[model samples]
Target: MATGADRTAFGPMVIVAADQHEARPLIDDPWARRLLPASGRLAAALTKYRPIRRALIAPTEKKIPGLWASMLCRKRYVDDALRAALDEGGIEAVVILGAGFDTRACRLPALAKIPVYEVDLPANIDRKRTALTKALGRVPANLTQVPVDFNTENLADALARHGYLPGRTFFVWEAVTQYLTEDGVRRTFDFLATAAAGSRLVFTFVRKDFLDGTRLYGAEAAYTEFVRKRPLWRFGLAPDRVEAFLAEYGWHEREQAGPEEFTARYLRPAGRDLPVSEIERSVLAEFTG
Candidate 1:
């Protein structure tokens, strides 16, 4: 299997469809189209045709069942939360852990004035730099790419080395927890626990039941691929216990949105009838310090 860097490809792939959606898109990031590989760019271009789009998406949806739609909803939710926090002021910095092909730093105008760090595996960071250069002619001046291997490195120390100061900050940990070990996840929280008062964190996680093979949640194919077959995913947090879990790290859940809420907030408004997977959900939390 390829390393974690290889998995970053999926991030751009998921958002490109939403970027090209016919109706009101849940999220808008034209940078997603620019960040893709040649074949992906071709596929993205083909999606401009409705019939071709449906035919291409139908099989993936049948196998993963709402994976694409749910991703779009989560992206929308996180983007809104980040913007709201930024507008509230006092946000000193933005740290995106496991930041893959995410384009927020380059595309979002609000982020242009803030110190933004994108932390990922070294290989992925290199890939991101190349993609950003290719897509935007040059990376934005406000962004910094930090490379760290979570399994062996200390999160706090690495960021500190990169000029990260502990203050009111916003952290994004999207689509990352499940791929990490339980200890890895806890160690990251240990770092978060030390953040200054009022730091915000937004993250996505798979349900423990789904991870353990107890409940497939209509995503049997995905479960088989990422869990049973290759075992790419390593950790899960029980939904009901997420708040208590965050509390252990000095964070309080502000909002935890699942499929039903996503459908109501994003899909329905956009006139999309796609089902959202119940296995994965997003949590927005604030550090109590």
Candidate 2:
């Protein structure tokens, strides 16, 4: 059973799951829809467990499917590219930052072959455990869950305690940075920088201008307004400046693509029919230490 804090921490799962559900059929991968029912269950649980925040999340859920579809179309390519880089480098360990109901550890065969360490708030982990147990009847053998409040825990210390090898790891920070403060994001990267020189990072960012625009869908605007009330959460990156930002922290940009480029590379021809204008508004980046 989750407490109020736990429920609150697991709130984002609803949004992500909702987004995946909407976008799954549009994806070329046959297994995409497999993630939907589980995501829906988790979303419902959070709603029942924490009504107010769930209500706040509802509006976002509406916009999520399309945005998520657009994002995942690109992310699938990025994730595959990152996996290829890891394979080429002989890196086997992976740490997923803010792993919210994400099924990569279970769904991606190549990723599942490696040991995956999923880091998130304690409540979210618990919620994920429950959801996975119910959906799959068992969690993946290679998936390990690490529970920590990023504000209170040192990522390095937590990784050390969890037996993460400093020299052989890949960190995937997906749609998580926007919820964190700039300093928090920097600290996370700094900690990763201390890992082995070859360790890599794959992440996505919403350009600040996307948030500044008012033409987003109704649900998008509602969620944005809600997030505005939370001081810790806001999209805070300009696509042009991300490479410079990473350079300052000892990471080298290995590859980067705007959403449109990503779609062109990974998505099927039909998936490409979706409007690309909004997709180009954000960027995905890969970095190597």
Candidate 3:
């Protein structure tokens, strides 16, 4: 059976679809059209495949019926916030760590002129490239995929080969932290500290309460599914502890928000129907180094 990175790889495809669903829709596209039989289009492309649809997605949603919708809305909220943060900092370079078929580099027009480096497990990178190539007939010029195993590789060395400049780069580290060991998470922060000043990070972390049974909307379902998943949640910080924690790593907190805050901020004001139980919180911080 596929365990570890192999199993974890499929998680992002779902995230990508949720992303397309919650974010701006295409000019005239159905949900299935948004997702299927194409790459570089939207997350919907992955959904088009029968094997993946049945194997990876079916079981997860079955475990928690509305969880898929919530995940999508969660992406909607976080991505919107990350875009604003990066834009404000001037996205000279974009590096998506643990990038799992995320199409942000192509989806956001402002990034067209900017170079994008997507770092992920090699297996997933190969899969993404193949799918995207099939979808677009070729990979987009602005996007560069740097395949690396975050557990063993030096992010700096890998990015350096791709012409990554540490200065003022915008980083997206969403939905990645909890899967990493504490050491692994620190290694990433260590790399960020090495980047040019004004470098910013946008990331999500599991909240402490969720693990303690103190929070979790569909508590039983959420906990059960997480346990069932191959890459289990290994780390989370108390909501109040994030700023101080990042400060120790030379990251100055710019924004910290819970799911409720994001829903009200990103969804409700826009008249979106997606509802997210404010479980995980996203934080935006800048590198002091």
Per-prediction RMSD in angstroms? 1.6, 6.3, 4.9
Per-residue lDDT tens digits for candidate 1, residues 1-289, read: 2445346555545455535667777677777777877777778888888887787767777767887787778878889999999989999999999888888997799998899999998877888899889887887888988988776689988998989888899999988888888988999999999998988999999899998989887888888888888887888999889999998989999999988999998888888888987888999999996
- Best by lDDT, which number? 1
lDDT rank order: 1, 3, 2
Question: What is candidate 3's lDDT per residue for 114-205, written digit by digit as tens?
Answer: 88899988877887787667667888899999988766779899999988876678888877787777888888888888877788788888
Candidate topping TM-score? 1
Answer with 2 or 3, whichever has the higher TM-score: 3
Residue 107 lDDT in candidate 2? 62
lDDT per model vs. reference? 0.84, 0.61, 0.68
Q: Could you give candidate 2's per-residue lDDT for residues 133-200 as a string of tens digits? A: 76678778888888876655788888778877765667787767766667777788778667666767
Which prediction has more favorable TM-score, 1 or 3?
1
The TM-score values for the models, in the order shown, are 0.95, 0.74, 0.79
Off by over 4 Å in 3: 1-5, 8-66, 85-89, 212-216, 228-231
